[model samples]
Target: MEGGLLFQFCNWSTLLVCMVIKVPQIFALLSAKSSRGVSLKSLLLELAGFLVFLRYQSYYSYPLLTYLEYPILIAQDVILLLCVFHYNGSMNQAIPYIAVFLGGWYLLALQKWIIDLAMNLCTFISAASKFAQLQYLWEARDSGAVSALTWSLSAYTCATRVITTLMTTQDLMVLVRFLIMLALNIWVTATILRYRKTATKDE
Candidate 1:
C-alpha cells in the first residue's frame, strides 16, 4: 500500500511538473514578441503528437494520472501556435489550418489500429520536428525567440519522466517515446546555447 501510494504521488507530481515546465515556453514566446527563433512547424507537429498520444490514452487498459494532462499539454502548444500567428501577423489566416489539422487528427482517433499507427507517426514527427527546428536555428544563426530556459526545463522534465515511467510501467513503446523526447530536448538545449552568440548578434 505504501509503495502504491508513493507511485501515485510521483505520478501526480510529475504530471504537475510537466505542466509547469511548459509554462516557461509560453511565457518565452510571449516575451519574445517574435517567433523567429522558435519553430512553428515543431509546435504544430508536437500538437499533433500530443493528440495522437491522447488517443492512445483512451485505449490504454490501466488508468494513468498523467493521461489527464494531455489536454493541458495540447493547450500549451495551441497557445504557442497562436503566438506564432500573432508574431506573423496572420492570426485569421492560420485559424483554418489549425481547425483542419485538428479535424483530421480527431477522425483518426476513432479507430484503435489507426490511432496506433498515428501514435508512431506522430512520435516520429515530433522527434523530427525538433531536428527540423534545429536546422532552422542553425541556418538562421539565431535563437532570439527561443528560450534557453524553456529547453532547459524541458530536458529536465523529460529526464524526470523517464524515471517515473520506469517506476510505474515496463511498456517498451512508452519508454521509447520518452527516450526520444529526452534526446531531442537535450539536443535543443545544447543547440540553443551554442548559438547564443550568433542569435544575440543578429538581434
Candidate 2:
C-alpha cells in the first residue's frame, strides 16, 4: 500500500511539473516576440503526436490524470504555434494549416487501423520533432530566442517522467518515449548554453 501510494505521488507530481514547465516557454516566446530559434515543423509534428496520444489514451481508458495531461500539452503547442505566426505577422496564413491539422486529428481517430498506424508513426514523429528543433537551433546558432530555462525544465520533466514511469508502469513504449525526450531536451539545453548570447539582439 505504501509503495502504491508512493507511485501515485510520483506519477501525479511528474505530470503536474511537466504541465507547469510549458508556462515559461509560452511567456518566453511572447516576451521575445519571435520564434526565431524554434522549429515550426517540430511544433506541428509534436502537436499531431499529442493529439494521437490523447485519443489513444481515451480509447484505451487510461487514468483520468493521464487523460487530463495531454490536453494541457496540446493547448501549449497550439499557443506556441500561434506565437510563431503572430511574430511572423502571418496569422492569416496559419488558419488553413490549423484547420487542416484539426481536421486530420478528428479524422484520424475514427478508424482503428489508422489509429494504430498513426500511433506508431506519431510516436516516431514526436521523437524526431526534437531533432527538428535541434536542427533549427544549429541553423540559427547566432540567435538565442530558444529559452534555456524552458528546455531545462523540459529535461527535468522528461527525466522525472522516465523515473516515475519505470518505477510504476514499466511500459516499454512510454519508457522509450520519455527517454528520448530527456535526451533531446538535454541536447537542446546544452546547445542553448553554447550559443546563447549574454544579450541577444532582436531579429
- Candidate 2 residues lying further than 4 Å off, grouped into runs, are 167-170, 197-203
Give residue 202's error in model 2 in angstroms: 15
Each prediction's TM-score against the native? 0.86, 0.86
Q: Model-by-model lDDT, in order?
A: 0.75, 0.75
lDDT (10s digit) by residue, model 2, range 102-155: 898788778898877777676688878888888887887743567778788778
How many pairs collide in each candidate, listed in order?
0, 0
lDDT score of model 2?
0.75
Assess candidate 1 and give its lDDT.
0.75
| Backbone collision tally, model 1 | 0
Winning model by TM-score: 1
